[model samples]
Target chain A: MLNCKQTTKLLSEKQDRPLSFRERVALRLHLIMCSGCTNYDRQMGFIRKACRRIGGDDAK
Target chain B: MNSERDGNTSKAAELWLQEAEIATLRRDMLRFAKLQLRDVATAEDAVQEALSAAYATRGRFAGRAQVKTWIFSILRNKIIDQIRSQTRHPTRSLTQDDGRNAEVGALFDDGGYWHKAARPADWGDPEAALGSEQFWVIFEICLNAMAENTARIFTMREFLGLETAEICTELGISENNCWVILHRARSRLRLCLEENWIKRG
Candidate 1:
């Protein structure tokens, strides 16, 4: 089982590339039990959305 | 005939830089400067200077988009000049990630478990925070707190919409290095925001 440290790092890496099938399954399983990592995942999604919105604002 | 010709040029200048557009454009310039310069006060000063310089040369501005591009160029130069004039802050060094990783490492205990105090709380309706002006102020503070290279890489990927391979090529760093920097930046930003914004809630 991946530890929280590895789980968090993997979640960040997921932003830059597609996680392997096994990796994805492992992360999903981990998030099922790890509330902290689950929250981290959602926060990452929110941050990404925020960045894109602000970046789009610059064009106009 | 000469008065009529002068009238055409003045009208074209007015169309290129309307009074209302200047207010919107200044905000854009200020945002750009703050991201790069990292000091809000300095960023505002740079934008002010750039706008003044652009105003002096406003007659030459050709179109709306052209005026934006032109003023942004001036702002970039102004920031570069400010960065050079000051004794460089060591924190601005690109290789500051090692120090940042050390700080991140402190958050986890030896078996790689989240430390008791560091466990992230569920951020209820986090997107709602984005709607407030205060939220952006805190967000900017968190982004400014990142390591120098990490901030650059993060902004390039997140803000500039650059791909991983393109970033690696542009920065002449290895692909692995690029991912490492990005990962570090992402994690840090999350922690920073959670600490400052979510925890406050």
Candidate 2:
């Protein structure tokens, strides 16, 4: 069982795209169960997007 | 006849080359290996060994992953061997009066005061700066500062876009272990960039 930190870290590493089916389900379940984790996930997404933009690898 | 056998061998080789289309991928692999080894000779040797092994055992590749992934797996193994062999003997001590140490040390102040480092005059939008050379420099410094194994895993996965399963297989690491290494690498990199680049803006 991965903690929120681990889960969000993996999410951040993934290239900009929608999560896989399993990931979507897992993330949804985690968000429903843990508000703190959900916020962390959102923050991670924001940072990743910002990094990609700065790195000039922004998604089409 | 011998002529027929020669023709068949040529045809087979040509077909394999067509199927593999390995030249561009080979260049990328070589560049990656060079970065990891930090020496041209060893990096080239690693690439050659990997290509030879891949050629001899090409049939083991099941085509599940992309061709680049498969070749990268072979190259990763070669690099691991190189790293292990290099580490087997006592190398240059880090405490030497080398300029390399001084340079890296200066990047961080006493108490690891990376937070006090200089910043970009205008970091510009984080989105727009991603493509700038500064990000890559910060990225390189952060990556070079990580532990060897951790840096290898991150480079293989993040820079090369390899799958976790492939990284584990090639690096002889468990899935969970790979994740942990990658986790640490990313967090450290994030912290480094925030302190050095992000905050500079």
Candidate 3:
């Protein structure tokens, strides 16, 4: 039900951890048929993890 | 039995304090600090000093923001202090009219232009790329490319774990304006990295 922009924002927030029930359902519904947003989600997650790993090295 | 209870209580208290300690917030705090000071050692010292203050005043940490966010607020103050304390004066003026600046015109044409900024890739498969090492290069390049102030704001909100409200309060900007600055910073970074790192390959 969420638009691509909202979906993308939620996906970014979810990257930090598990999504809430409403968000989980919304993301599932959105990704079920929307390839672009799904790809966006994946990319966002990748960037976050990459940055965190880089941060991990700096903390040492 | 009483002694055992007291020992357990002490252990629990220690763990609680450790969880709220500044070192626990290092990953993001240092990143934010480095953005300001531009030197890793100086940034680390600033963050360490902020953490010490936070520990001393841990009770003041309103749970409204994440622990990382609270520590970052302290770090910001510390960085400002360090900058203000620097007593060294510049050896030479930075006037552009000096003959030494005459060569600068060659970097651009008579119309005044530099290299066209890069654009982000279409992000063909974001899911597959997330958590990849190559992505870190993009992240670093994009982050570093941002304006110092923009980078500070974004790093504080996203990397350092502060809420938009807290950031706005500290930076003395409106809520909507804070979001705007963050958005611009992210977009610029995305475009810069897309052009430099992704397209190059």
Candidate 4:
């Protein structure tokens, strides 16, 4: 099982590239059991959205 | 009648150009350039060059993209040229430095879990942050606070949406090191936003 630190690292990495099937499965299982990691994932998504807005690249 | 209509059409085009608000466009271009170049003087030069290029080519703009988008693309090319020139000089490595190691250590415990105090808190209504100019002000400060190379990598990925391969090729770093730099940048930005903007009420 991926710990919080490892899971969060993977979560951040997903923003830059697609994850493999095995990596996705591991992350999914960890997120299911871990609320903290789940929240971390959501915040990461928020950051991506906020950055798109601030950078004005959302139109592109 | 045909000659008169042509004159009217030309007049409207002149009015449209007059309405483009060059000053605001320059400010926005400077903000983006500074973020990517991380140097005020270079960013100013890039924006100046881009604006002039835009003016010189205004007739070919064709109105396909937003005015801002068109200018931004020009500025993007300028930034790429700057990056290429810097790479040729090879002044420094883009890989992890000692300070980055300390930053990475602070986020993880010996057991490889998020350090208790370092874990992220729920940031309610992320849209609120997006809607406020004040939020972006703090966000820019946080971005500038990061290591220059790390900030460059992060902006290339997040702001420019460049692929990892492209970023590695441009910066002359390996794929693995690029990912590490991005991870560190994200972790630090997340914490900075949470403390400085999200948690402030």
What i-RMS does every model get?
3.0, 9.8, 9.8, 1.8
Docking class of 4: medium
Per-model tally of clashing residue pairs: 0, 8, 5, 0
Global lDDT of each candidate: 0.77, 0.57, 0.57, 0.78
Where is the poorest 10-residue window by lDDT in model 2 chain B?
A: B113-122
Q: B1-201 in candidate 2: lDDT tens per residue?
A: 457759967654643445345775566566667657877888788888877887787666656345455666677777767755654543433222323334433534454323234211223345555456666667566667776656666665654456778766665556766665565556566556667876664
User: What's the ranking of the predictions by TM-score, best on top?
Assistant: 4, 1, 3, 2
In terms of docking quality, model 3 is: incorrect
- Best prediction by lDDT: 4
Misplaced by over 4 Å in model 2 are A1-60, B1-34, B40-125
Residue range with the least summed lDDT across 10 consecutive positions in model 1 chain B: B84-93
**TM-score (2 decimals) of chain A in model 3:** 0.76
Candidate 1: list runs displaced more than 4 Å.
Answer: A57-60, B1-22, B37-98
- lDDT tens digits by residue: candidate 3, B1-201: 457759967654543346545345675577656765778999888878887887787665556336555565677667655643541332332121334223322423343322222112357655445455575556666687665556666665555556777766665566666665554554455445556666775
Residue B30 Cα positional deviation in candidate 3, in Å, after optimal superposition: 7.5
TM-scores for all candidates: the values are 0.71, 0.45, 0.46, 0.87
Candidate 3 wrongly placed segments (more than 4 Å): A1-30, A57-60, B1-32, B36-138
Q: Candidate 4's error at A41, in angstroms?
A: 1.9
Each candidate's fnat, listed in order, reads 0.69, 0.03, 0.08, 0.56
- CA-based DockQ, model 2: 0.09
DockQ for model 1 equals 0.51
TM-score, cand. 2 vs. native: 0.45
lDDT per residue for candidate 4 within B21-71, as digits (tens), equals: 776667667888898898899999998998788878877766734766777
lDDT score, residue A42, model 1? 90
lDDT of 1 by residue, B59-156 (tens): 77766666676777787667655644442343343544466688778889999989988887788887777668778888888888886667777877
Error of 1 at B180 (Å): 1.5
